[model samples]
Target chain A: MATEGEGSGFAIHPMDQFVIKPLFGGEHVHWYTISNVTLWMALAVLCIVLLLVVGTAKRSIIPSRVQSVAELVYGFIYNMVEEVTGHDGVKYFPYVMTLFLFILFSNLLGLLPMSFATTSHVAVTVVLALMVFVGVTVLGFMRKGVGFLGMFWVSSAPLALRPILALIEVISYFVRPVSHSIRLAGNILAGHAVIKVIAGFATLVVASPFVVGAVGAIYGLELLVAVVQAYVFTILTCVYLRDAVGDAHH
Target chain B: MATGTETAAEAAGHGGGHAVGMPQLDFSTWPHQIFWLLVTLVVIYLVLTRLALPRIGGVLAERSGIITKDIAIADDLKQKALKAERAYNDALAQARADAARIVAEARAAIQADLDAATARADAQIMAKAAESEGRISEIRAGALDAVTEVAQDTAHEIVAALGGKADAGSITAAVAARLKE
Candidate 1:
């Protein structure tokens, strides 16, 4: 399968890092199968529990390190929801917090050596994005009823251009989940793949030093990406929520 | 290096002897990934909604509430201190005024006593001076009478030595006139 150029003991399979393998060692990944995806995701859940539950068990006025971390994450997402969705949107704080913690831990945990990045997969991110999309759509309809469709309709535009503007608005609205999921998956997938490709070059004895240095630098960047991607996803969720809960800007 | 190559070969075998384009695009694993993702999301949602968020929110609210209560108590204490200081100042001013009044009253009382003593002393001195003056006049009167009697006796003896015999009544009359002059 090697193009003759890479046959000289210099091979790079960047995508292999994303492949799902059963945790208990099986070739087939059945729907109910316990795979690496479950392990990392479960680890993320454990981390969330430890930070949120056990860390704050004392319920101290002055928080411990872990408790403060939990509180900081809580406050950060809480404030984001409050600011973006306004006062009325604070009801959705837990949902947004859940999304942020899951993505954040998944991305960070995936950076470990030989660990599968669950967020790097489109299948995982699409479900997350769709949840937000569907939840927001239902909430918008529930709260504002038919007036929710008014979001796509640009009322301020000229009557003749209103339909065109709305068409664009509707397209963009539907495209939100696609773009949202792709953005996160693409970023993680790209960063991991780039690092893998660079590491593959370490086989050439001369490039080994540069490769190591580059990998370190890219790893640092990926850490920042992991956090930023989480923030972006959470903030976008809040922005969508604003449409449902907040007063109409149009 | 051997393990790396072995894993690479094994991955290739899994990929049908070629690297898969993108494991993300593999539809066969989508359902598996989706199911777990849903499970993970549900668990997280439940954990957060049930436990974490409410606790954190309660802690924050409680902290702010404590801070606000502390501030209010501090403010109340400050006001009380100010009131106490004002009361202290008022009492000090009142005591100062009372002390001044007492001193003035004491001074007035002492002055009245001194004035009364001085007036009494003057009345006594005046009475003693009047009595002394009355005694001096009486003594002057007595000395005048003695001088008059002596002059009469001398006049009578002189007339007798001159061998001039006079009547007793005349002699007495002449002595009386001379004494009068």
Candidate 2:
């Protein structure tokens, strides 16, 4: 927010891309105002439906390319959910899969030139992270009841150190959503910002070629980060859900 | 970056009510973004649960079921084929056994016929031999009688020629008694 790359004749304002404005000609945003974030998010769902629903309309034993993709994603999520959370947690597979697909699509689609990244915005990611946090917490309490609190209560330590460990555990447990949301957003935000910074350096006459090359290379790395961040976010959700169903805490 | 964006915004004549900070930090759009996110997530969830997931899961289960049923049917057919082969073998063995029994009966019947023919031939040969022996005896008797008469004549002539006392009847009786003994 403090740096200015306007020393050269070309004043490249990379952070301007992150600005959220009303889709229509309006100075103020309303609750129902159509925005770029809304458009991209809807597009993500459209892609998902097209891929999953339309692709598998035939449901042939021998899958078409579209059906293959849909089934592959389904099986991938199904196996991950089963492995991380066990069969007992598979009942919630649809919800977890939905979240994973939505985030994955958002991250990948955000990589398009001149496109907005939904996952980079805390407003978007916080809601997703909070959903997992709340859902898992509710499930934990419902399934394990008071025993769920035992996660924070360390039993294997000396009596004096036990309280300190328990306090630390409690703080860390509450920090799950904060870190979960911020981790994805921060990774995406940092990558995009770095690319913008490198692109802005392309305006320099002497360093133009190197800066452009570096930007291209960073774009490739950003693509990997896009998928990896989504994977990490999803697997972490599965791990938390496992704690809920299995209650490894106690 | 602040002055640069401001200068750029000024150059574009897009003046913000307050300096446009990080668009993500803009609280005014949070409601818009969050509201849409919530709506979209709910929509995605409903779409998946209602349509996409169940369809995909159903296809998988149906494929598995088809494969399992096909395997079971194949197994059933294989078992039937084995049963047919076993029945065919039993029938083949029965036919071989029947053929052997028939051959054995035919040989026994032929042997019985051969034994009867041999017995009849031996009886005929014995009868022929008896008849021939009877003829020979008769002929021998006739020859013996002739020889006795000749011996008697010779004896009588010798007695007459030598002028000695000799009887032809006595000589013939003695010769006949010796032949009988």
Every candidate's chain B TM-score: 0.51, 0.44
Q: Give the top-scoring candidate (TM-score).
A: 1
Cα lDDT tens digits for candidate 1, B1-181: 1343444434533533344556677667778889999999999999988898889989999999999999999999999999999999999999999999999999999999999999999999999999989998999999888776676677667878898876667776787787677
- Interface DockQ per candidate: 0.31, 0.26
Question: Deviation in angstroms for A175 in model 1?
Answer: 0.8
Error of 1 at B59 (Å): 1.4
The TM-score each candidate achieves on chain A is 0.97, 0.94
Q: Which 10 consecutive residues of model 2 chain A have the lowest summed lDDT?
A: A2-11
The residue-by-residue lDDT of candidate 2 on A1-250, one tens digit each, is 5246456566555566666655665655667878777889989999999999999999899889999899999999999999999989899999999889998999888889889888888988899999999999999999989988888777888889988999898888889999999999998888888888778777678989999889889999999999889889999999989989964744
Per-residue lDDT of A1-250 in model 1, one digit per residue for the tens? Answer: 2223346887777887887877776656678989888999999999999999999999999989999999999888888999999999999998899899999999999999989899999989999999999999999999999999999898899999999999999999999999999999999999998998899889899999999999999999999999999999999999999999999988
Candidate that would win on lDDT: 1
lDDT of 2 at B26: 57
Residue B16's lDDT in candidate 1: 39
After superposing candidate 1 on the true structure, give the runs of residues whose Cα lies further than 4 Å from its correct spot. A1-7, B1-19, B100-181
